[model samples]
Target: MTTPTRPPKTRRRPEWLVPAGLIALSLVPIVAGSARLTQLTTGAAVTAENARFFDSPVPVVTHIVGSSVFLVLGALQFAPSLRRRRWHRIAGRIVAPAGLLSALPALWMTVFYDIPTAVSGPGLAAVRLVLGTTMAAAILVAFIAIRRGDVRTHSAWMTRAYAIGLAAGTQVFVFLPYTLLAGTPSPVVYTLLMTAGWAVNLVIAEVAIRRRARGPRRRTGTTVTAAGARLS
Candidate 1:
């Protein structure tokens, strides 16, 4: 009698893991944005940290609400099961516009908000302008790519845009150590931290895109090898 055959080892598919992690990372900024929105709507105590928001409520509100929608719903787009369904297309329509609304107003705030130099120096403002422009441009390119039926390009661009938009979430982690070790950061230090967050996200996005691009080739190679083995 032969020994019992071993059960086939199946690899776990982390379909939900990326989306869940993204949503979790986004919670800090989402909660903070909600609090700011409440303060704006409810006539709460206006402190120096938020007086600018009160003075220029429209852009801030648009940015907060739009970003919340973009990040939360957009994160769901990463779910492979959802992408296989029609929900992905429907959500894409909403996510693209939401991304634009989130990004454009950020540029507006960066240019016209009149934030004090002590709070956000020229360096930080410049970086914000660059990142906002990049995010908006990436979304636009992604939309155009999908329209042209270039799905690979569309996905790559969308990933870049999402990564840039998610920088706010990552900024919380980036600033925590600095805040704890140094008590408070100077405007220069703040700018550096912000840059680091954006840089980290963009780098990660690039790596992911590259790896995804290779996946199909790898599968094709494996398929060909299996076929050749059968033939031999």
Candidate 2:
């Protein structure tokens, strides 16, 4: 007679509080400034000034396609139905490719993108390239894992990757608090906020991987065991 072997125990990972904090952070711009939308736009590296690509109509195509990819993929993150149905299989088919396409334009656009996100100077280009490239790479790997039916690996990587993908909007808060309290210059605060955004999103991704690796637990049903012991 042999005892059943249990599944391997997984290491724990930290969960991000930012999603819940998103509401509070989102309010700062609205409460402090009359031009919430405009402020958000200023935070982006992309602007009307250097929006050219491939000599003719690259910006237009990138904007339209990238915007669509980001909008759809970001929305899919919090969607309970998709998560419940384990729809990553279906969504991955579309999302993985879209993310890849978006990354190219994001990296290319960085050439003309001179804005510093926090920490300052020429390093901004490196920061943008690294964040964009890592996100694209993660999705590609996760997509491959899913095609092979590696559910745990797939979910972990994809969720973490998506966290970075969604960081642009969430990053606004990292420095918004200090900006509000100190009343510092917009350029100074905006940069801090953006840098913090990417870092936090990466943390968010690690959290997702940890949570998913743990998976759902089976409900314990009360029962009587042998040897006069109670087991549930």
Candidate 3:
């Protein structure tokens, strides 16, 4: 008898890619935030860039810490293997509260902080307000959805919330080319770049959400066809 040959096993996509990319994207902002936190805690030299943070430290500190937790811990939630285990729920609990802490303090600072007009003009302030509110609201909606056993809606809203929270990291990359070519952007240009960063993140989040929504249906269809073939 001829030896039977077994088909080669298909390689599964690495579950780490999504989370690793996200954490890498978050690194720049996290490092910057850490420096700021160290400055605040250790009473380091305060320059014009950091003076505002010193003036009202609470909101900025809360924002930095909360956002760091949200971004780093939240990234892990994207891993398929992690999501399949109990880690997802545990991370979600921490991530939701961290997101709220980040967004709410960000809104507070945006409204009340004595930010210079050059750094954050009225247009940028408005954008910050809207996105901050949206992030907070999205977290709340996701929490409610999960509580009601609506997993799909919960996942979609959490993805949106995470995108907004991660916008700062994206902003660094978005501004790099402009900063390099033009040598430090004007305030208007800065605002535009920031908006572009947030827009890019939100668009990507929507695409991912749609793809995830379609995934189950595709699997179900494949299984049904296979079953029919077997029966026939």
| lDDT-best of 2 and 3 | 3
lDDT of 3 by residue, 1-232 (tens): 9764543444667889989999999898799899888899899997877788999999998998899999999999999878889989998889999999999999999888888766764499999999999999999999999999999999999999999999988998898888888887788887899999999999999999998876632232133231223111
The 10-residue segment of model 2 with minimum total lDDT is 28-37
Question: TM-scores of all models?
Answer: 0.89, 0.62, 0.88
Poorest 10 consecutive residues by lDDT, candidate 1: 223-232
Q: Over the stretch 1-232, how does candidate 2's per-residue lDDT look in tens digits? A: 9765544555643223433354344343334322423434465344444233223345435534553554455445545445556584566677777666667677776766443343353455677788788878887888789789887777777666666656655756565677678765465445556777878877876875776555555433433342324454
Per-model lDDT: 0.88, 0.58, 0.88
Error of 2 at 107 (Å): 0.5
Candidate 3, run of 10 with poorest lDDT? 223-232
Off by over 4 Å in 3: 1-11, 216-232
Q: What is the lDDT of residue 4 in candidate 2?
A: 52
Residue pairs whose backbone atoms clash in candidate 2 = 118-191
Residue 188, candidate 3: alpha-carbon lDDT? 84
Stretches off by above 4 angstroms in model 1 are 1-10, 216-221, 224-232
